[model samples]
Target: MTQPLAELDDVRARLDADLDEVTEPLAASALAEASDLAREYGRDWVDADRCPRLVRGLVARATARFVRNPDGYARSRSGDESVEWAEGAAGDGGVFYTEPEIRLIRSLAGRSDIHSVEVIAWGTRQTDRTGYIPVEDGKPFPYFADESEPW
Candidate 1:
């Protein structure tokens, strides 16, 4: 199997948590999931060893978020206190990359938003015997006065 982009140690560092039977396994699983997700988002273009630090950071951050809120809780409250999850939070108790993360992955994978194409326009001839006319500055070249046929 391919190596994970981020390691357990990476997740642990992000979470600032001590290793333990529970946290270790959870963090490891989260790291694996996050790495897999990043690879998939990159459409198999992402290399664990060759990926940028930002990619690794994304994996670590995603893993840490998953470990912290596995249930994908949007909010929690106790008595008068309340908590609300911000945008880009994990969803439905699953590991996921945020929008910005996905954009980064796409960019790294060479999927660009801007696109361009070259167009060649062969203008129609006034008649079959005439030479082919060419387009100039996006407009077809007008026929010379001598080239015009009598009405």
Candidate 2:
């Protein structure tokens, strides 16, 4: 059974507290390992004893991936082609790391030289066809000559 959202929040809160105090050199590495664990086991709920470890892992991986290569990762992350959330996709439910957590991780990981990492939030593409009106039904198709004008 999926754990209640409240439990997930509790885990998030604990992680936030932990990140505040993380300064050890090995913390990132250990959290990297914990990340693997969180990926496998954190979906429903992180076990209390393991919760801090897993949160650290989430922070570590998020920070590492962004810190190691900021521009390249940012470009890919913001692009429409990036892999997005989909049910039953391979390696889905591999932990939940929020933007706040990632930011905290970046600070704790000591990659202060790099100023920013851009990330585009994503979700599953809307699959329901209700939004798509059939052209064959003689519906007026909207068009704009200058596509760049919207921005």
How many pairs of residues collide in each model?
A: 0, 1
Candidate 2 TM-score, true structure as reference: 0.21
Q: RMSD in angstroms, candidate 2?
A: 20.7
Look at candidate 2 and tell me the lDDT of residue 111: 35
Q: Indicate the TM-score of model 1.
A: 0.65
* Model 1 per-residue lDDT tens digits across residues 18-137: 768877788887788888888877756356678877788898999898888887878889987886665554646778888888999878777777999976554542335344456664
lDDT of each: 0.75, 0.39
Candidate 1 — which pairs collide?
none
Q: Model 2: which residue pairs collide? A: 31-57
Q: Name the weakest run of 10 consecutive residues (lDDT summed) in model 1.
A: 123-132
Which regions of candidate 2 deviate over 4 angstroms? 1-33, 36-91, 113-151
lDDT (10s digit) by residue, model 2, range 3-85: 22223233334343333333232334434443543434433234334345435445455434332332323233455677444
- Global lDDT for candidate 2? 0.39
